[model samples]
Target: MSTMTVKRAELKPGEVLCSYCTARCCRYFALPIETPETWEDYDHMRWYVMHGSCAIFVDEDVWFLMVYGDCKYLLEDYRCGNYEDRPQICRTYTTDECEYDNDGTYDRLFETPEQIWEYAHAVLPPKKKKKKKKSATEVSHQKLPIVHI
Candidate 1:
Protein backbone atom coordinates (compact mmCIF):
# COMPACT_ATOMS: atom_id res chain seq x y z
CA MET A 1 0.00 0.00 0.00
CA SER A 2 2.72 2.48 -0.79
CA THR A 3 1.40 5.80 -1.96
CA MET A 4 4.40 6.39 -4.19
CA THR A 5 4.23 2.99 -5.80
CA VAL A 6 3.00 2.10 -9.26
CA LYS A 7 1.79 -1.31 -10.32
CA ARG A 8 3.46 -3.09 -13.21
CA ALA A 9 0.50 -2.52 -15.49
CA GLU A 10 0.49 1.12 -14.53
CA LEU A 11 4.20 1.72 -14.93
CA LYS A 12 5.21 4.65 -17.15
CA PRO A 13 7.40 4.17 -20.20
CA GLY A 14 11.13 3.48 -19.61
CA GLU A 15 10.65 2.47 -16.00
CA VAL A 16 12.21 -0.63 -14.44
CA LEU A 17 10.87 -2.05 -11.17
CA CYS A 18 13.98 -3.94 -10.20
CA SER A 19 15.98 -0.71 -10.03
CA TYR A 20 13.65 0.53 -7.32
CA CYS A 21 13.90 -2.76 -5.43
CA THR A 22 16.31 -3.50 -2.62
CA ALA A 23 16.62 -7.07 -3.84
CA ARG A 24 13.96 -8.33 -1.48
CA CYS A 25 13.68 -11.64 -3.33
CA CYS A 26 17.43 -12.22 -3.07
CA ARG A 27 17.28 -11.88 0.72
CA TYR A 28 15.13 -14.98 1.20
CA PHE A 29 13.76 -18.13 -0.35
CA ALA A 30 10.44 -19.86 0.31
CA LEU A 31 9.56 -23.51 -0.21
CA PRO A 32 6.08 -24.95 -0.10
CA ILE A 33 5.41 -27.63 2.52
CA GLU A 34 2.64 -30.20 2.80
CA THR A 35 -0.37 -29.23 4.84
CA PRO A 36 0.19 -30.37 8.42
CA GLU A 37 -2.07 -33.38 8.97
CA THR A 38 -1.11 -34.44 12.50
CA TRP A 39 0.43 -33.12 15.67
CA GLU A 40 3.79 -34.59 14.74
CA ASP A 41 3.67 -32.79 11.41
CA TYR A 42 2.99 -29.52 13.18
CA ASP A 43 5.81 -30.25 15.60
CA HIS A 44 8.12 -30.68 12.65
CA MET A 45 7.11 -27.25 11.43
CA ARG A 46 7.79 -25.90 14.89
CA TRP A 47 11.27 -27.34 14.73
CA TYR A 48 11.87 -25.63 11.39
CA VAL A 49 10.91 -22.22 12.71
CA MET A 50 12.98 -22.72 15.84
CA HIS A 51 16.11 -22.57 13.72
CA GLY A 52 15.95 -18.73 14.02
CA SER A 53 16.45 -17.86 10.34
CA CYS A 54 13.28 -19.33 8.93
CA ALA A 55 9.52 -19.00 9.29
CA ILE A 56 6.26 -20.67 8.32
CA PHE A 57 3.68 -18.83 6.30
CA VAL A 58 0.31 -19.59 4.78
CA ASP A 59 -0.64 -17.77 1.60
CA GLU A 60 -3.78 -18.59 -0.37
CA ASP A 61 -4.21 -21.85 1.57
CA VAL A 62 -0.70 -23.06 0.81
CA TRP A 63 1.98 -23.47 3.47
CA PHE A 64 5.52 -22.31 2.86
CA LEU A 65 8.76 -22.36 4.82
CA MET A 66 10.64 -19.11 4.28
CA VAL A 67 14.40 -19.19 4.84
CA TYR A 68 16.16 -15.86 5.22
CA GLY A 69 19.61 -15.70 3.70
CA ASP A 70 21.40 -13.56 1.22
CA CYS A 71 22.51 -15.27 -1.96
CA LYS A 72 26.28 -15.48 -2.23
CA TYR A 73 26.09 -13.95 -5.67
CA LEU A 74 24.36 -10.83 -4.37
CA LEU A 75 26.69 -7.84 -4.47
CA GLU A 76 26.80 -4.94 -2.03
CA ASP A 77 24.96 -2.72 -4.50
CA TYR A 78 21.88 -4.95 -4.40
CA ARG A 79 22.75 -6.52 -7.71
CA CYS A 80 23.56 -10.10 -8.62
CA GLY A 81 27.24 -10.76 -9.16
CA ASN A 82 26.48 -13.63 -11.51
CA TYR A 83 23.82 -12.00 -13.55
CA GLU A 84 25.26 -13.20 -16.87
CA ASP A 85 25.55 -16.76 -15.56
CA ARG A 86 22.49 -16.75 -13.34
CA PRO A 87 20.49 -19.91 -12.81
CA GLN A 88 17.48 -20.80 -14.92
CA ILE A 89 15.06 -20.04 -12.10
CA CYS A 90 16.37 -16.52 -11.90
CA ARG A 91 16.36 -16.17 -15.65
CA THR A 92 12.69 -17.07 -15.80
CA TYR A 93 11.65 -14.66 -13.06
CA THR A 94 9.35 -11.81 -14.00
CA THR A 95 8.45 -8.52 -12.43
CA ASP A 96 4.73 -9.25 -12.61
CA GLU A 97 4.97 -11.15 -9.33
CA CYS A 98 7.54 -8.86 -7.74
CA GLU A 99 6.85 -7.38 -4.30
CA TYR A 100 9.12 -4.38 -4.54
CA ASP A 101 6.41 -1.81 -3.90
CA ASN A 102 3.67 -4.08 -2.67
CA ASP A 103 3.18 -5.24 0.85
CA GLY A 104 4.28 -8.90 0.91
CA THR A 105 2.60 -10.06 4.09
CA TYR A 106 1.26 -13.58 4.09
CA ASP A 107 -2.20 -14.50 5.30
CA ARG A 108 -0.74 -16.26 8.33
CA LEU A 109 2.88 -16.05 9.46
CA PHE A 110 4.45 -18.16 12.23
CA GLU A 111 7.85 -16.82 13.30
CA THR A 112 8.34 -18.88 16.46
CA PRO A 113 8.16 -22.54 17.51
CA GLU A 114 5.64 -21.71 20.19
CA GLN A 115 3.41 -20.01 17.63
CA ILE A 116 3.39 -23.10 15.44
CA TRP A 117 2.72 -25.39 18.40
CA GLU A 118 -0.09 -23.16 19.58
CA TYR A 119 -1.65 -23.36 16.12
CA ALA A 120 -1.40 -27.16 16.20
CA HIS A 121 -3.05 -27.28 19.60
CA ALA A 122 -5.79 -24.99 18.40
CA VAL A 123 -6.67 -26.91 15.21
CA LEU A 124 -5.82 -30.52 15.99
CA PRO A 125 -7.68 -32.80 18.39
CA PRO A 126 -6.26 -33.53 21.81
CA LYS A 127 -3.48 -36.10 21.95
CA LYS A 128 -4.62 -39.47 23.27
CA LYS A 129 -2.94 -40.74 26.43
CA LYS A 130 -1.56 -44.26 26.45
CA LYS A 131 -2.90 -46.69 29.09
CA LYS A 132 -0.38 -47.73 31.73
CA LYS A 133 0.76 -51.35 31.61
CA LYS A 134 0.66 -53.41 34.79
CA SER A 135 3.85 -54.97 36.16
CA ALA A 136 4.41 -58.77 36.37
CA THR A 137 4.26 -58.61 40.22
CA GLU A 138 0.71 -57.27 39.94
CA VAL A 139 -0.70 -60.35 38.21
CA SER A 140 -4.22 -61.67 38.93
CA HIS A 141 -4.75 -63.65 42.13
CA GLN A 142 -4.58 -67.47 41.87
CA LYS A 143 -3.96 -70.56 44.02
CA LEU A 144 -0.49 -70.50 45.68
CA PRO A 145 1.78 -73.17 44.17
CA ILE A 146 4.76 -72.75 46.56
CA VAL A 147 5.18 -75.69 49.05
CA HIS A 148 8.81 -75.40 50.18
CA ILE A 149 9.74 -73.18 53.17
Candidate 2:
Protein backbone atom coordinates (compact mmCIF):
# COMPACT_ATOMS: atom_id res chain seq x y z
CA MET A 1 0.00 0.00 0.00
CA SER A 2 1.22 3.48 -0.81
CA THR A 3 1.98 5.59 2.25
CA MET A 4 0.01 8.80 2.20
CA THR A 5 1.73 11.66 3.98
CA VAL A 6 0.34 14.96 5.15
CA LYS A 7 1.76 17.71 7.33
CA ARG A 8 1.85 16.87 11.05
CA ALA A 9 -0.89 19.41 11.81
CA GLU A 10 -2.88 18.17 8.85
CA LEU A 11 -3.31 14.96 10.81
CA LYS A 12 -6.04 16.59 12.90
CA PRO A 13 -6.76 19.62 10.74
CA GLY A 14 -10.39 20.21 11.59
CA GLU A 15 -12.54 17.05 11.33
CA VAL A 16 -11.66 16.35 7.73
CA LEU A 17 -8.20 14.96 8.41
CA CYS A 18 -9.39 12.38 10.94
CA SER A 19 -12.40 11.51 8.79
CA TYR A 20 -10.04 11.16 5.88
CA CYS A 21 -8.17 8.47 7.76
CA THR A 22 -11.57 6.84 8.39
CA ALA A 23 -10.69 5.56 11.87
CA ARG A 24 -8.47 2.94 10.28
CA CYS A 25 -7.10 1.84 13.64
CA CYS A 26 -10.52 1.33 15.20
CA ARG A 27 -11.85 -0.32 12.06
CA TYR A 28 -9.17 -2.97 12.05
CA PHE A 29 -10.46 -6.27 13.49
CA ALA A 30 -9.40 -7.25 17.01
CA LEU A 31 -10.56 -9.34 19.96
CA PRO A 32 -9.32 -9.77 23.53
CA ILE A 33 -7.68 -12.99 24.65
CA GLU A 34 -8.84 -14.10 28.06
CA THR A 35 -5.99 -13.73 30.58
CA PRO A 36 -3.39 -16.35 29.58
CA GLU A 37 -1.95 -17.78 32.79
CA THR A 38 -2.04 -21.46 31.88
CA TRP A 39 -0.28 -23.32 29.07
CA GLU A 40 -3.60 -24.43 27.64
CA ASP A 41 -4.81 -20.84 27.43
CA TYR A 42 -1.59 -19.84 25.71
CA ASP A 43 -1.83 -22.83 23.39
CA HIS A 44 -5.34 -21.74 22.43
CA MET A 45 -4.00 -18.28 21.75
CA ARG A 46 -1.22 -19.82 19.62
CA TRP A 47 -3.81 -21.27 17.28
CA TYR A 48 -5.66 -17.97 17.15
CA VAL A 49 -2.57 -15.85 16.58
CA MET A 50 -1.23 -18.13 13.81
CA HIS A 51 -4.18 -17.63 11.49
CA GLY A 52 -3.43 -15.48 8.45
CA SER A 53 -3.31 -11.70 9.07
CA CYS A 54 -3.53 -12.20 12.84
CA ALA A 55 -1.40 -10.27 15.38
CA ILE A 56 -1.27 -10.03 19.16
CA PHE A 57 -0.53 -6.74 20.90
CA VAL A 58 -0.68 -5.23 24.35
CA ASP A 59 -1.19 -1.55 25.19
CA GLU A 60 -1.21 0.20 28.53
CA ASP A 61 -2.33 -2.72 30.72
CA VAL A 62 -4.69 -4.54 28.34
CA TRP A 63 -3.98 -7.25 25.79
CA PHE A 64 -5.59 -7.30 22.36
CA LEU A 65 -5.52 -9.90 19.62
CA MET A 66 -6.04 -8.37 16.22
CA VAL A 67 -6.44 -9.15 12.53
CA TYR A 68 -5.78 -6.51 9.92
CA GLY A 69 -8.74 -5.22 7.97
CA ASP A 70 -9.72 -1.85 6.50
CA CYS A 71 -12.57 0.46 7.43
CA LYS A 72 -15.83 0.34 5.52
CA TYR A 73 -15.48 4.05 4.61
CA LEU A 74 -11.81 3.82 3.64
CA LEU A 75 -12.25 4.87 0.00
CA GLU A 76 -9.94 3.78 -2.80
CA ASP A 77 -7.98 6.93 -1.98
CA TYR A 78 -8.29 6.31 1.79
CA ARG A 79 -10.65 9.03 2.90
CA CYS A 80 -13.66 9.17 5.19
CA GLY A 81 -17.31 9.69 4.23
CA ASN A 82 -18.38 11.92 7.12
CA TYR A 83 -15.32 14.00 7.79
CA GLU A 84 -17.15 16.88 9.46
CA ASP A 85 -18.84 14.87 12.22
CA ARG A 86 -16.25 12.17 12.74
CA PRO A 87 -15.91 10.60 16.18
CA GLN A 88 -14.09 12.64 18.82
CA ILE A 89 -11.38 10.00 19.30
CA CYS A 90 -10.50 10.16 15.61
CA ARG A 91 -10.61 13.94 15.60
CA THR A 92 -8.17 14.11 18.51
CA TYR A 93 -5.72 11.47 17.25
CA THR A 94 -2.41 12.71 15.85
CA THR A 95 -0.51 10.81 13.23
CA ASP A 96 2.72 12.14 14.77
CA GLU A 97 2.25 9.60 17.58
CA CYS A 98 0.46 6.75 15.89
CA GLU A 99 0.83 3.18 14.74
CA TYR A 100 1.76 4.46 11.28
CA ASP A 101 4.70 6.15 12.94
CA ASN A 102 6.09 3.44 15.25
CA ASP A 103 4.19 0.62 13.54
CA GLY A 104 3.03 -0.40 17.04
CA THR A 105 4.45 0.06 20.55
CA TYR A 106 2.94 -2.84 22.45
CA ASP A 107 4.74 -3.67 25.70
CA ARG A 108 4.83 -7.21 24.37
CA LEU A 109 4.20 -8.01 20.75
CA PHE A 110 3.72 -11.57 19.56
CA GLU A 111 3.92 -11.61 15.78
CA THR A 112 3.20 -15.28 15.20
CA PRO A 113 1.70 -18.42 16.75
CA GLU A 114 5.15 -19.92 17.10
CA GLN A 115 6.22 -16.94 19.15
CA ILE A 116 3.29 -17.38 21.53
CA TRP A 117 3.84 -21.16 21.77
CA GLU A 118 7.51 -20.66 22.56
CA TYR A 119 6.70 -18.18 25.29
CA ALA A 120 4.13 -20.54 26.79
CA HIS A 121 6.36 -23.59 26.59
CA ALA A 122 9.28 -21.70 28.11
CA VAL A 123 7.19 -20.76 31.15
CA LEU A 124 5.01 -23.85 31.49
CA PRO A 125 5.94 -27.51 31.27
CA PRO A 126 4.14 -29.73 28.76
CA LYS A 127 1.72 -31.86 30.76
CA LYS A 128 -1.07 -33.88 29.18
CA LYS A 129 -3.89 -35.56 31.10
CA LYS A 130 -5.35 -38.95 30.23
CA LYS A 131 -9.08 -39.41 29.88
CA LYS A 132 -10.78 -42.02 32.08
CA LYS A 133 -12.95 -44.61 30.30
CA LYS A 134 -16.13 -45.98 31.87
CA SER A 135 -17.88 -49.17 30.81
CA ALA A 136 -21.70 -49.60 30.75
CA THR A 137 -21.59 -51.84 33.89
CA GLU A 138 -19.48 -49.29 35.71
CA VAL A 139 -21.84 -46.53 34.71
CA SER A 140 -24.87 -48.49 35.96
CA HIS A 141 -23.08 -49.50 39.15
CA GLN A 142 -22.43 -45.84 40.00
CA LYS A 143 -26.22 -45.20 39.99
CA LEU A 144 -28.32 -45.71 43.14
CA PRO A 145 -28.56 -49.46 43.91
CA ILE A 146 -32.02 -50.93 44.68
CA VAL A 147 -32.57 -51.57 48.46
CA HIS A 148 -34.57 -54.82 48.91
CA ILE A 149 -34.90 -55.34 52.69
Candidate 3:
Protein backbone atom coordinates (compact mmCIF):
# COMPACT_ATOMS: atom_id res chain seq x y z
CA MET A 1 0.00 0.00 0.00
CA SER A 2 1.29 3.47 -0.95
CA THR A 3 0.85 6.37 1.55
CA MET A 4 -0.16 9.86 0.31
CA THR A 5 0.50 13.17 2.11
CA VAL A 6 -1.94 16.05 2.09
CA LYS A 7 -1.17 19.71 2.76
CA ARG A 8 -3.62 22.26 4.14
CA ALA A 9 -3.90 25.67 2.49
CA GLU A 10 -2.76 28.67 4.52
CA LEU A 11 -4.36 32.13 4.46
CA LYS A 12 -2.45 35.40 4.58
CA PRO A 13 -3.21 38.21 7.03
CA GLY A 14 -6.76 39.51 6.53
CA GLU A 15 -6.99 37.34 3.43
CA VAL A 16 -10.45 36.02 4.22
CA LEU A 17 -11.89 39.51 4.73
CA CYS A 18 -9.79 41.05 1.97
CA SER A 19 -10.99 38.53 -0.59
CA TYR A 20 -14.45 40.12 -0.48
CA CYS A 21 -13.39 43.61 -1.44
CA THR A 22 -16.88 44.75 -2.31
CA ALA A 23 -18.08 43.98 1.26
CA ARG A 24 -21.34 42.71 -0.13
CA CYS A 25 -22.58 41.44 3.22
CA CYS A 26 -22.03 44.81 4.84
CA ARG A 27 -23.69 46.73 2.02
CA TYR A 28 -27.22 45.43 2.33
CA PHE A 29 -29.84 44.08 4.72
CA ALA A 30 -33.18 42.35 4.15
CA LEU A 31 -36.41 42.65 6.09
CA PRO A 32 -39.09 39.98 6.12
CA ILE A 33 -42.30 40.79 4.21
CA GLU A 34 -45.73 39.21 4.11
CA THR A 35 -46.39 37.18 0.98
CA PRO A 36 -48.32 39.38 -1.45
CA GLU A 37 -51.89 38.11 -1.81
CA THR A 38 -53.56 41.08 -3.52
CA TRP A 39 -52.90 43.53 -6.34
CA GLU A 40 -52.41 46.34 -3.81
CA ASP A 41 -49.75 44.38 -1.97
CA TYR A 42 -47.97 43.57 -5.23
CA ASP A 43 -48.31 47.18 -6.36
CA HIS A 44 -46.71 48.38 -3.13
CA MET A 45 -43.84 45.99 -3.66
CA ARG A 46 -43.44 47.30 -7.20
CA TRP A 47 -43.19 50.80 -5.78
CA TYR A 48 -40.40 49.61 -3.50
CA VAL A 49 -38.46 48.17 -6.43
CA MET A 50 -38.87 51.43 -8.34
CA HIS A 51 -36.55 53.19 -5.89
CA GLY A 52 -32.79 53.06 -6.33
CA SER A 53 -30.94 50.22 -4.58
CA CYS A 54 -34.16 48.58 -3.49
CA ALA A 55 -35.11 45.00 -4.38
CA ILE A 56 -37.26 42.06 -3.37
CA PHE A 57 -36.45 38.38 -3.08
CA VAL A 58 -37.68 35.09 -1.76
CA ASP A 59 -35.63 32.45 0.04
CA GLU A 60 -36.91 29.09 1.26
CA ASP A 61 -40.51 30.32 0.86
CA VAL A 62 -39.79 33.41 2.95
CA TRP A 63 -40.12 36.76 1.23
CA PHE A 64 -38.00 39.80 1.99
CA LEU A 65 -37.57 43.43 1.05
CA MET A 66 -33.89 44.00 0.39
CA VAL A 67 -32.44 47.48 0.80
CA TYR A 68 -28.96 48.16 -0.53
CA GLY A 69 -26.87 50.65 1.39
CA ASP A 70 -23.40 50.59 2.82
CA CYS A 71 -23.12 50.10 6.54
CA LYS A 72 -22.03 53.19 8.47
CA TYR A 73 -19.21 51.22 10.08
CA LEU A 74 -17.67 50.06 6.81
CA LEU A 75 -14.48 51.93 5.98
CA GLU A 76 -13.20 52.93 2.54
CA ASP A 77 -10.88 49.93 2.52
CA TYR A 78 -13.84 47.59 3.01
CA ARG A 79 -12.95 47.01 6.64
CA CYS A 80 -15.26 47.53 9.57
CA GLY A 81 -14.25 50.53 11.62
CA ASN A 82 -15.86 49.13 14.75
CA TYR A 83 -14.80 45.53 14.39
CA GLU A 84 -13.75 45.29 18.01
CA ASP A 85 -17.14 46.50 19.23
CA ARG A 86 -19.34 45.32 16.40
CA PRO A 87 -22.96 44.42 17.04
CA GLN A 88 -23.89 40.88 18.03
CA ILE A 89 -25.53 40.30 14.67
CA CYS A 90 -22.44 41.43 12.84
CA ARG A 91 -20.20 39.37 15.06
CA THR A 92 -22.35 36.31 14.51
CA TYR A 93 -22.16 36.56 10.73
CA THR A 94 -19.80 33.96 9.28
CA THR A 95 -17.92 34.30 6.04
CA ASP A 96 -18.64 30.71 5.00
CA GLU A 97 -22.40 31.40 4.84
CA CYS A 98 -22.04 34.84 3.29
CA GLU A 99 -23.68 36.23 0.12
CA TYR A 100 -20.34 36.09 -1.68
CA ASP A 101 -20.43 32.31 -1.38
CA ASN A 102 -24.00 31.85 -2.63
CA ASP A 103 -25.33 34.73 -4.66
CA GLY A 104 -27.90 32.61 -6.51
CA THR A 105 -29.76 31.29 -3.46
CA TYR A 106 -32.68 33.68 -3.96
CA ASP A 107 -35.68 31.94 -5.52
CA ARG A 108 -36.98 35.13 -7.10
CA LEU A 109 -35.24 38.50 -7.16
CA PHE A 110 -36.81 41.68 -8.53
CA GLU A 111 -34.35 44.46 -9.25
CA THR A 112 -36.74 46.84 -11.00
CA PRO A 113 -40.41 47.84 -10.93
CA GLU A 114 -40.88 46.44 -14.44
CA GLN A 115 -39.64 43.07 -13.26
CA ILE A 116 -42.05 43.12 -10.32
CA TRP A 117 -44.90 44.27 -12.55
CA GLU A 118 -44.21 41.46 -15.00
CA TYR A 119 -44.34 38.95 -12.18
CA ALA A 120 -47.53 40.56 -10.82
CA HIS A 121 -49.26 40.28 -14.19
CA ALA A 122 -48.43 36.59 -14.32
CA VAL A 123 -49.48 35.74 -10.76
CA LEU A 124 -52.09 38.31 -9.76
CA PRO A 125 -55.73 38.22 -10.82
CA PRO A 126 -57.08 40.93 -13.13
CA LYS A 127 -58.81 43.90 -11.51
CA LYS A 128 -62.61 43.81 -11.50
CA LYS A 129 -64.60 46.74 -12.93
CA LYS A 130 -67.74 48.06 -11.25
CA LYS A 131 -70.78 48.46 -13.50
CA LYS A 132 -72.55 51.84 -13.53
CA LYS A 133 -76.15 51.99 -12.18
CA LYS A 134 -79.04 53.45 -14.22
CA SER A 135 -80.15 56.95 -13.10
CA ALA A 136 -83.79 57.80 -12.02
CA THR A 137 -84.30 60.00 -15.14
CA GLU A 138 -83.21 57.12 -17.42
CA VAL A 139 -85.61 54.77 -15.62
CA SER A 140 -88.53 57.24 -16.09
CA HIS A 141 -87.82 57.42 -19.86
CA GLN A 142 -88.71 53.70 -20.26
CA LYS A 143 -92.25 52.88 -21.56
CA LEU A 144 -94.74 52.44 -18.64
CA PRO A 145 -98.20 50.89 -18.44
CA ILE A 146 -101.01 53.53 -18.79
CA VAL A 147 -103.27 54.00 -15.72
CA HIS A 148 -106.90 55.18 -16.15
CA ILE A 149 -108.63 57.24 -13.47
Candidate 4:
Protein backbone atom coordinates (compact mmCIF):
# COMPACT_ATOMS: atom_id res chain seq x y z
CA MET A 1 0.00 0.00 0.00
CA SER A 2 1.28 3.44 -0.93
CA THR A 3 1.47 5.96 1.94
CA MET A 4 0.75 9.61 1.43
CA THR A 5 3.60 11.92 2.44
CA VAL A 6 3.17 15.63 3.02
CA LYS A 7 5.52 18.45 3.85
CA ARG A 8 5.01 19.09 7.57
CA ALA A 9 5.74 22.83 7.25
CA GLU A 10 3.10 23.50 4.57
CA LEU A 11 -0.03 22.06 6.25
CA LYS A 12 -1.38 21.75 9.79
CA PRO A 13 -1.73 18.34 11.42
CA GLY A 14 -5.48 18.20 10.75
CA GLU A 15 -4.98 19.10 7.10
CA VAL A 16 -2.26 16.45 6.81
CA LEU A 17 -4.62 13.79 8.14
CA CYS A 18 -7.45 15.09 5.93
CA SER A 19 -5.33 15.03 2.78
CA TYR A 20 -4.36 11.40 3.36
CA CYS A 21 -6.73 9.32 1.20
CA THR A 22 -6.73 6.23 3.37
CA ALA A 23 -7.92 6.40 6.96
CA ARG A 24 -5.18 4.09 8.20
CA CYS A 25 -5.96 4.62 11.88
CA CYS A 26 -9.65 3.77 11.45
CA ARG A 27 -8.93 0.56 9.53
CA TYR A 28 -8.11 -1.52 12.60
CA PHE A 29 -8.27 -1.77 16.40
CA ALA A 30 -5.94 -3.58 18.76
CA LEU A 31 -6.73 -5.04 22.15
CA PRO A 32 -3.93 -5.67 24.61
CA ILE A 33 -3.36 -9.36 25.44
CA GLU A 34 -1.24 -11.32 27.87
CA THR A 35 1.98 -12.59 26.40
CA PRO A 36 1.65 -16.25 25.43
CA GLU A 37 4.05 -18.45 27.39
CA THR A 38 2.52 -21.90 27.68
CA TRP A 39 1.27 -24.33 25.01
CA GLU A 40 -2.33 -23.69 25.96
CA ASP A 41 -1.84 -19.91 25.82
CA TYR A 42 -0.26 -20.19 22.40
CA ASP A 43 -3.04 -22.57 21.32
CA HIS A 44 -5.64 -20.01 22.33
CA MET A 45 -3.78 -17.32 20.43
CA ARG A 46 -3.73 -19.65 17.40
CA TRP A 47 -7.49 -20.00 17.69
CA TYR A 48 -7.82 -16.21 17.76
CA VAL A 49 -5.71 -15.82 14.61
CA MET A 50 -7.71 -18.50 12.79
CA HIS A 51 -10.68 -16.17 12.57
CA GLY A 52 -11.02 -13.86 9.55
CA SER A 53 -9.50 -10.37 9.72
CA CYS A 54 -7.73 -11.21 12.99
CA ALA A 55 -4.06 -11.05 13.85
CA ILE A 56 -1.66 -11.06 16.80
CA PHE A 57 1.06 -8.49 17.20
CA VAL A 58 3.76 -7.71 19.73
CA ASP A 59 5.04 -4.18 20.14
CA GLU A 60 7.69 -3.32 22.74
CA ASP A 61 7.00 -6.55 24.67
CA VAL A 62 3.27 -5.82 24.78
CA TRP A 63 1.02 -8.24 22.89
CA PHE A 64 -2.22 -7.31 21.19
CA LEU A 65 -4.87 -9.02 19.13
CA MET A 66 -5.51 -6.79 16.14
CA VAL A 67 -8.95 -6.91 14.52
CA TYR A 68 -9.03 -5.42 11.03
CA GLY A 69 -12.33 -3.65 10.38
CA ASP A 70 -13.29 -0.16 9.36
CA CYS A 71 -14.76 1.99 12.10
CA LYS A 72 -18.56 2.33 11.81
CA TYR A 73 -18.28 6.14 11.86
CA LEU A 74 -15.66 6.31 9.11
CA LEU A 75 -17.13 7.55 5.81
CA GLU A 76 -16.10 6.62 2.26
CA ASP A 77 -14.02 9.80 1.95
CA TYR A 78 -11.87 8.80 4.96
CA ARG A 79 -13.59 11.17 7.32
CA CYS A 80 -15.44 10.47 10.52
CA GLY A 81 -19.21 10.62 10.13
CA ASN A 82 -19.67 11.87 13.70
CA TYR A 83 -16.77 14.22 14.04
CA GLU A 84 -18.73 16.68 16.15
CA ASP A 85 -19.92 14.05 18.62
CA ARG A 86 -17.07 11.63 18.30
CA PRO A 87 -16.01 9.52 21.27
CA GLN A 88 -13.54 10.82 23.83
CA ILE A 89 -10.85 8.41 22.57
CA CYS A 90 -11.22 9.78 19.05
CA ARG A 91 -11.21 13.36 20.28
CA THR A 92 -8.00 12.77 22.22
CA TYR A 93 -6.26 11.11 19.28
CA THR A 94 -3.63 13.32 17.69
CA THR A 95 -2.49 13.06 14.11
CA ASP A 96 1.02 14.25 15.01
CA GLU A 97 1.75 10.95 16.77
CA CYS A 98 -0.22 8.18 15.09
CA GLU A 99 0.20 4.64 13.78
CA TYR A 100 0.33 5.92 10.19
CA ASP A 101 3.94 6.94 10.54
CA ASN A 102 5.13 3.87 12.45
CA ASP A 103 3.05 1.05 11.01
CA GLY A 104 6.01 -1.35 11.03
CA THR A 105 7.05 -0.78 14.66
CA TYR A 106 5.74 -4.12 15.88
CA ASP A 107 8.45 -6.31 17.38
CA ARG A 108 6.61 -9.45 16.29
CA LEU A 109 3.43 -10.07 14.31
CA PHE A 110 1.41 -13.22 13.68
CA GLU A 111 -1.19 -12.94 10.91
CA THR A 112 -2.12 -16.65 10.88
CA PRO A 113 -2.49 -19.53 13.35
CA GLU A 114 0.22 -21.47 11.55
CA GLN A 115 2.65 -18.64 12.10
CA ILE A 116 1.84 -18.42 15.80
CA TRP A 117 1.97 -22.20 16.18
CA GLU A 118 5.35 -22.34 14.48
CA TYR A 119 6.68 -19.61 16.74
CA ALA A 120 5.27 -21.38 19.79
CA HIS A 121 6.99 -24.60 18.83
CA ALA A 122 10.24 -22.78 18.28
CA VAL A 123 10.13 -21.02 21.67
CA LEU A 124 8.44 -23.61 23.90
CA PRO A 125 10.02 -26.87 24.99
CA PRO A 126 8.66 -30.09 23.47
CA LYS A 127 6.15 -31.83 25.70
CA LYS A 128 7.34 -35.17 27.05
CA LYS A 129 4.96 -38.12 27.06
CA LYS A 130 5.19 -40.47 30.04
CA LYS A 131 4.75 -44.24 29.51
CA LYS A 132 2.01 -45.81 31.61
CA LYS A 133 2.75 -49.04 33.44
CA LYS A 134 0.35 -52.01 33.37
CA SER A 135 -1.91 -52.28 36.45
CA ALA A 136 -1.62 -55.25 38.88
CA THR A 137 -5.21 -56.33 38.13
CA GLU A 138 -4.53 -56.54 34.41
CA VAL A 139 -1.24 -58.40 34.91
CA SER A 140 -2.73 -60.96 37.35
CA HIS A 141 -6.10 -61.24 35.57
CA GLN A 142 -7.87 -60.53 38.85
CA LYS A 143 -11.07 -58.52 39.16
CA LEU A 144 -12.67 -56.81 42.13
CA PRO A 145 -16.16 -57.87 43.27
CA ILE A 146 -18.95 -55.64 41.99
CA VAL A 147 -21.49 -54.23 44.52
CA HIS A 148 -25.18 -54.43 43.64
CA ILE A 149 -27.37 -51.43 44.28
Please state the error at residue 45 of candidate 4 in Å.
Answer: 0.3
- The residue pairs that clash in candidate 4, if any, are none
TM-score for predicted model 2 compared with the true structure: 0.58
Clash list (residue pairs), candidate 3:
none
After superposition, which runs of candidate 1 have C-alpha atoms over 4 Å from their true positions? 1-10, 133-149
Candidate 4 per-residue C-alpha lDDT over 1-149 given as tens digits, one digit per residue, 9 for 90 to 100: 22557554566644654465477788999999998889999999999987879899988899999999999999877888999999898889886767554646579989988999899989999966778887987868866689999
For all candidates in order, the CA lDDT equals 0.86, 0.69, 0.79, 0.82
Which prediction has more favorable TM-score, 2 or 3? 3
Model 1 agreement with the true structure over 10-43: per-residue lDDT tens digits: 7678877776667888999999999999988998
Model 1 earns a TM-score of: 0.82
Ranking by TM-score: 1, 4, 3, 2
Candidates 1 and 2: which is better by lDDT? 1
Question: Which candidate number maximizes lDDT?
Answer: 1
- Quote the positional error of residue 34 for candidate 3 in Å: 0.8
Q: After superposing candidate 3, which stretches have Cα over 4 Å from the reference?
A: 1-21, 131-149
Which residue pairs collide in model 2, if any? none
By lDDT: ranked, best first: 1, 4, 3, 2
Measured against the true structure, the TM-scores of the candidates, in listed sequence, are 0.82, 0.58, 0.72, 0.78
